[model samples]
Target chain A: MTASIIEDRGEGSPRNGEADGFPTATPLPVRTSEKGEEENPSSILLGTSAEDHHIARMAALALGLSVLEAAIPSPLPGVKPGLANIVTLIVLARYGWRTAAWVTLLRVLAGSLLMGSFLTPGFFLSLSGALCSLAVLAASQHLPSRWFGPVTHSIFGAFAHIAGQLLLVYFWLIPHTGLAYLVPIFAAAALLFGTVNGLVAAHYLDKNPINHKIQRHREMRPDCL
Target chain B: MLSIAHIKPGDWLTLLLGALLTAFLGVTLWQGGAADKAIIRSGGKIFSVVPLSRNQLISVPGPLGISQIAIHNLQARIASDPSPRQYCVRQGWLKQAGEVAVCLPNQVSVELSGKQKNYDSLNY
Candidate 1:
């Protein structure tokens, strides 16, 4: 049992026959006869916890919002209202910054992949924006909660998002002083969208019925996530 | 459905800060810096770098013929080009830094360079 516990399984080994942290008395029966002689028996299956499920669900919600946003005709490129941020703000207020970061990054990666912009300049820009915003939120969330709320964090996150993208554009893509001229427009958009998203997040945080379930779950598992 | 009552004091502070930042960027970046010199390229090679202070006309020999460029009032423009399209001549004035006028047929291009760069990229 100790040897099996210490042994490193193949990278793609299936988890069906093994218990998580607990050794099984007998191996699960292999029903390979019905399937015939399999050419490839390797399989990959990860043991996901409840928190993973929550993050995956929230990430799917954010992706849905992103898809809706992509359909809207924006006046300027790289200047959208960032509707998906509402979910990040809600998650931050409920689950904390780590969970919020997970949701935001997953949204960016999955959203870009869905849009077929993976590994492109657009994907990098979105990645930088998400990272910068998450950093800002992580810091700003530490402020006294009495005065500050999701709205404040949202605005700061939005500004950081645009700042990150613009710097990337100036340094990597354009490398021109001319790009500075677009800063004002981008800043204005960030301010407007940040406030709007923050308000929406605040409203959702206050009114959503899901908060009760989340609160109950948090109380049950105080430190898992 | 949220209202003004839902806004917190910190939210107001953030709004004030974001607005001030946007205004500051608008004031500073909207206007490009004054150009310092004009760079003339003829047939893919640099013909000369002329100061905008000196009001003069430079005749650059290109593939087709001579192209004349004038600099005056801290601005430069293509006065005449042997190119049939006259696109460079029609460009009128290059007042800001990084502004460029090119005559493809004559293989002549004039650009303004200074401490700051002008907006040139439009990504769709």
Candidate 2:
């Protein structure tokens, strides 16, 4: 259905549309375009590998969630439900930590840019939060799958995320011990949101489990899949 | 929807640990420790450290003028500040360690400290 929409939009000039942004599985034309370009139009495609495209799409989804979350009024400056983390949890469970990290970091960077907070203290706080959560997720992903799942990972990630951001606020921004008073409130938020996000991720993963054949194929030849 | 059956032992463990962590943070970081002394600084320098137990009025010289810090009944407060805005003066009282009141324009600040150093370097 999505492919058909893309094809319909690109019907006017398929190669041009593909060259601009929308990457398709269709083979690139060997011959130069009628526009008299010397190089292959495929060269204009931003991402060559399937993984890059996957990450880009996932990142875009996460960015949308971040924007949506920003619209909701928060009680405290740093206290947010972090709805984008749900997408990160889903990506981590489905694809893997590396892909999830790419999606998450890209979302943070692009989200900051979109919010006009890039390079500001807010951006650093956000970056630190994302980094700490990613680290926790990466480590927790190694735990026994039989015993642990997305919810467990989400809790750890959420705690780490808030902890990192609070530490940054104390040392970098406020530089006062008074900030410690807010830790419990932020931690409570982390716990609540973490459990909620983790449950969502678990339910989604359970409904749409990884295809064993595809997983095997990817393990055999990672680039091809 | 996630049923109770979907939560594994590890998930329960995580939830438990997260609750414990939050409780720990609430207990330790929420209300600061009892302060024993008040450290006053003027012009970016430590002017004096006075015991909170002994009630006294400290007059510290700053850029704007003189700032008066009052310590009474184991509590400290900025009695007066020469700065335009009496922010520090209006900050009522400081009885907990790590509490601080700053008169920016006057370049005077007072911070409460506890016996065991409310927080170490690593806590930052």
Candidate 3:
């Protein structure tokens, strides 16, 4: 994981590397001669790197939550607490939007496969909802972090997700005039669940911040030098 | 640990937005009360159209049994039903143009329709 993060820093623009407080421009030779020479054989054979493993771990966590949620019978067909969204929020806060997007897409794919809903209407709805939430999260980044946190982002994502699914249903699945009246109910549910999930994500982020972990790892690495 | 103690402007913004959305929906629901009639359906077919202006009681045959509906003072409600859940009755009253009360087990539903429809369909 450290190696992959270093590689990311090394490949990023100088300004980005500087922002991360890493001297990427001059570290390539040292990195390759030392740790890069001892690449793990399993990672090489599988064509998976530390970064892929990191994404996989997050996706797996989200998939587990999705499966768990499915086990509980819900009164409404489309309404679920959406606890899996917590992983996406954490990834977005720690790793940035691109990584969060990858994690979210992976979760949707893997989760559908696990639930045996792949290629079904359920899968399409999940895909659309995930994409919509990610788009909303991306847009919400424009808001000042000081004023916004995981909870706010979660609310936005939830509303966007429901809107996306409803639009699809209206246009393709059921074009009947009766479906629009349920929007208020669904919107209320989204607000409630979104706030809950956001608070959970915020708690997790507060306790286990990725930047602090990274900084600690960096500080401890010189002990082995 | 990174601690977040206070609600920020963004948090307030989201809360305000959510409140605004709720208010908008509430207003729409309130405005929907102008509906003139209630359209009742049984087994996916139009069972009856009762004028909201009249005070009357109507019983429609449904899957489970007869679902009784009452219309009075420009509003309609499910008075009684044989359905176990009685969800339709729990919906209370429908005065809005797009309001609906459904008894899924009995396959009975009542929807309001007015001169001007506020929404084409609701998505959930």
Candidate 4:
């Protein structure tokens, strides 16, 4: 796991959105996945105790947010690289699929609580997106990695995320009149923006070679190949 | 500037699929513009939120054509509508849904309810 170094905000005043009554959702630190699950080693060692669980819960908060910050719109306001997703991909690439899936659930819960959008349809929408990405990662097993470059991986995963959102909204719960249309608009948004994120991520990976620290057997594998 | 050489086939497929989905949605929403009487019981404040006549309803014109908004408060009534506003009158009346049409101090907010309409639900 990459050692996370967060800038500490003192006990003085609350963070930007914290003063609005709702406590800012604290995130958990990154941890290794065992049995393809988001297991914070600290909490596991401390036992299934409630306080440890709370600490584990806070770990995914900021990292999940970072994934979201990635997807950028071409026009800027809408353009962003799905950065937080890199975390998702990384989790999957290292720990396998289930751990990434669990991480996504945690991210959804944390993001909703932090954004004060808990239980809203929008929260569910985000969950669907994460699930969609998971689906892509799962399905990618059939294809050659050479076909899925960092950019393509991000793009396909983003498409899956958005498609999952549309599927959830249009099929299961509240059937609004024309929500079916939001799929394509958002999918377009995902693809158009997703490509840029993928490219940037690709560039980043190229620039930052892996150190001898993390023992990754798949390091020999090309992400695109 | 980024090159398209890096884009994958799946990328194009997703974009095409997304566009097709949008086209279908636009048509459905446009065709089914009218919603039936939905009575929501919220907070004990009676709300009459549905449309009186398909034609009498005040709809804001956009790319989607018209949006039906119902009024809520007495304050909203005092305010002047650029046109004769008639969302106040409707078929079924109830208030528990937390939807109210307010024509208040220089403002108009026709609370739209996300009920009964077949909006999409999360499946998998």
Best by TM-score: 1
Q: State which candidate, 3 or 4, has the greater lDDT.
A: 3
Which is the better candidate, 2 or 4, if ranked by TM-score? 2
Model with the higher lDDT, candidate 2 or 4: 2
lDDT of 4 at B1: 45
Reference contacts preserved by each model: 0.82, 0.73, 0.42, 0.20
User: Each candidate's DockQ score against the native complex?
Assistant: 0.51, 0.36, 0.25, 0.11
Docking class of 4: incorrect
Candidate 2 per-residue lDDT over residues A128-157, each given as its tens digit: 999999988889998998999888998999
Q: What is the per-candidate TM-score for chain B?
A: 0.78, 0.72, 0.71, 0.26
Give candidate 3 regions above 4 Å deviation. Answer: A1-46, A212-225, B1-6, B29-33, B36-113, B116-124
Model 4, span B77-117: residue lDDT tens: 21223333434333233232223444332133443333344
- In model 1, pairs of residues that clash are none
Model 3, span A1-86: residue lDDT tens: 22322223223233332333222213332122334457753332223334456667778888888999999898888999998898
lDDT string, candidate 1, B1-124, tens digits = 6787768898898899999999999998887678899999987899899999999999998878999999989999999988888989998999988889999999999999987556566553
Question: For candidate 4, lDDT tens digit of each residue in A100-203?
Answer: 56566677777678777778887887788787787887776446545555665676788777777667866776465355434445655676656666665555
lDDT of 2 at A213: 44
Q: Where's the lowest-lDDT run of ten residues in candidate 3 chain A?
A: A22-31
The lDDT of each candidate is: 0.81, 0.80, 0.76, 0.49
Q: Look at candidate 2 and give me any clashing residue pairs.
A: none
Better of 1 and 4 by DockQ: 1
